[model samples]
Target: MLNLFSRNKQLLDEEIINWIFDSYDWAFKQFDPSVFFEETELVLPTNQYFPGEQNSINGMANLIFEQVKQHAGMTHWPTKLLNVTESEHQPVNPATLSVKGQLRGKQAQASFELGSSVEALSEDTKPTETKPAVTKATSTKTTSIKNNAFDESEYSTDLNLVMSAGHASEPNTGNNSINFSFHPQQLNSPEGLIAHFAQGLAQHLVSAAENPPPGGKEYLPVATELMGIFMGFGVIFANSAVVPRQGGCGGCGGGQSPVRQVVLNQDEATYALALFCCLKGIEKKQVVKHLKKHLRGLFKLALKDCERRLKQESRLSLSFAS
Candidate 1:
């Protein structure tokens, strides 16, 4: 179980909450109140460690499921979850599960392209890969300071490896001049977390479009209501983590210490990138195109894995009932 120690756990929880509020604030700014208030309620799952007993991953999942069902016109919930047969005592790591599933509702039948980078969109000309120059200053009288160039190549290599594994790229999709890159590093960094939350917002959008809940037009307002929740909370988390604040320094019993609290490590960035990719729409044609260019066999294997998981789940549930 994840431990909540010192103020770290509390801070992380607050950060997550702030992200939700920031999302809401942004929506209200645009004159959208549906998110803040809606008579209808949807059940969704939350993280297991969420404060209230009511707030859990299962709860959040249920909430999202209900919203999607209402939008999709699903009269009942998908109670038949893929029984996580894996050991609970062990550290929770979904990726480790050799088991994979492809529920009919969650299957990716479409393809998507990456948006251009923000820099690319703003600048008239495309950015050419340029190396940063490094210089060392030598002074006998003073400490010799070496202005070492940032190892951008190292960063690029790591980012490239992940992109290659995930098989995502910024292929201009249309007139949607949105340019963005899911840098694994950024997910942990100030910008990365914003991007991460944005990815969640994107996921909500994709989920809404792909899996609308049981309700018809009645829940549209509520679904969109979440937009503000996402924006408001996102901004707060980003600003609070990035903007430097002064506090008492340890060295001087009472001295000014400048510090930026939130930091995004590499792992977080990779997760964020995955989220971004998940949000991107995949067209059937694009999938076929990719198959033609890449290892067609592995693509089939991945799909087969999805099919096998769904079948296995169905079988397990049936066995339990019998």
Candidate 2:
């Protein structure tokens, strides 16, 4: 597996990295991803920034992921848009402020400020029609239903598909445990799976081309791996955070956009799937370990932010008492 990584990893990564960095250089004339994912720091009387940096981190992660997902395989997605900052407080140098950056699922091309929050948005339209499955010849085939009236056996098969898709559960269950799944829709055809990533690759070509990063060659392998991970992760579980997996992201909720927190452990399943797709290897232990690593990264970020907020609160209390 490491040999496989060593052999083709450079090509995979460099392709993604160059496209991203080049796109940014070509369009904006300035290589800054923050133009798409940026935060404005407001000057508070003591030292409190509402929404906080952690919130900024979370929001930026989501924003980058959204852009990567939508345009990751697009042919005509825009690479640059106007940069406008709207904030409550004025600062002398806004560019110096630190904010998180990511290019996960899709790119956010347009943004608007609504009172206290900033919203970056993009649009995509995919054909709703399902692709026809290719029929392959098999030596030993199950009996096909003749032009049917109500066939009990046929009814059983369809029912099984429904149940399998909806009722299957992960073996392990806990607060942080991931619910393992193999979506029936995807499992129906290998061609469908191939086409899915083909579309994704096309989307990423456009996305990375339009929104290239400054990291240069080092960026591609990680970005490709990241995208492969993102795609693979979407496959192993049915969730809304990463992609519109299991059609869960579409439901209505207070007219607000769906808020999905991709469980970090899901990345293990994702890594396994990507390897299977890209490298054709499956190691269960490796999958679990990768998932744990992703979870640790997320937990570390969340914990660090929580610590910072707590310290801020403590300092405020002392100041008030004084």
Candidate 3:
């Protein structure tokens, strides 16, 4: 009967804890552990990490994307950005002022005649050569499409067509471009945008892995969320995991509730964050101030739990080695 008064101390289930450790080990193996041990920095929401003005949504998204890419060590990957809106509305095409750059493997000079219609003519096919309107040449082989106006609807369709034609024309040159799409609402929430970008990039990293995660394909989403934490965006993900929602009473403030938008819940995300901090040897004081008021206690609990767990693992490993 005395056991009824005893408190259960574990924050997460045993299964979840094992999955977190196993997935983290997989990530450590996939992306060099040396980098995680010595290089990766915990990305904060302050201007020091995300400097500059928040003037345009696209501009801001691009800036954040670059920062996330740099922190995640994915700077070398070829990528394209697309701001996708709701599908119901008619999407206008951004104005394409110019298209310049050489096609891969073909020495043919192509000219685009633009006025009422757009046409592409090769040097070998055209009898008369007209001076190109806009010509921007680059040493690297890339198709540059400059848009005076930013529009998502037409741009998505046009880019797909261009990419498809390029692939059809030259199938040997592998297309390695990754397109990242953002919703219109994401611009308002910086932390949400960061979480989305981190997850999107993490998905790419997972897809490129030689083997599946610890629990296999079914746990892909959970693993991806954890991988984002491993990429140094744990603070962002943890804080933005649960968002408060107002009831349908409008200004009456009658029915207020909390909604879980992302895959990981508050406890899971906080525990993962604590795991990240503990593994990196980061002190709790450095991270506590950044978390939500309620989560601060949970984070502390998670930190202690992670530390104890790691110590046990270390002891076991030493015994096995001996």
Q: Residue by residue across 12-108, what tens digits does model 2's lDDT show? A: 2334333332332332332232322232111111111111111232232222322333433221222221111322331111111111222222342
Q: Which candidate is the best by TM-score?
A: 3
- Candidate 1 local lDDT, residue 250: 17
- TM-score, ranked from best to worst: 3, 1, 2
For residues 1-322, what per-residue lDDT tens digits would candidate 3 score against the true structure?
Answer: 5686577766889898878877887876555565666667887755567654433455556667777777776664445555555234322221111223321111323232223212211111110121111222221123322221112321111111011112121111222234455664555455666777777666655644556788897776677778889878898787656543332121133221121136777678888888888878788888876665667788998988877777778522321211
Give the higher-lDDT candidate: 1 or 2.
Answer: 2
Compared with the true structure, all predictions reach lDDT values of 0.24, 0.26, 0.56
Which scores greater on lDDT, model 1 or model 3?
3
Regions more than 4 Å wrong, model 1: 1-29, 39-172, 181-184, 188-191, 195-322
Candidate 3 clashes between residue pairs 3 or more apart in a chain or in different chains? none
Question: Which candidate number would show the highest lDDT if scored against the true structure?
Answer: 3
- Give the root-mean-square deviation of each candidate in angstroms: 24.8, 22.9, 16.0
Clashes of each: 59, 23, 0
Q: What lDDT tens digits, residue by residue, belong to model 1 across residues 174-292? A: 44222222222321232222323333233223232323422433433333324312322221222222221234221123211112112332222112211111122222233322111
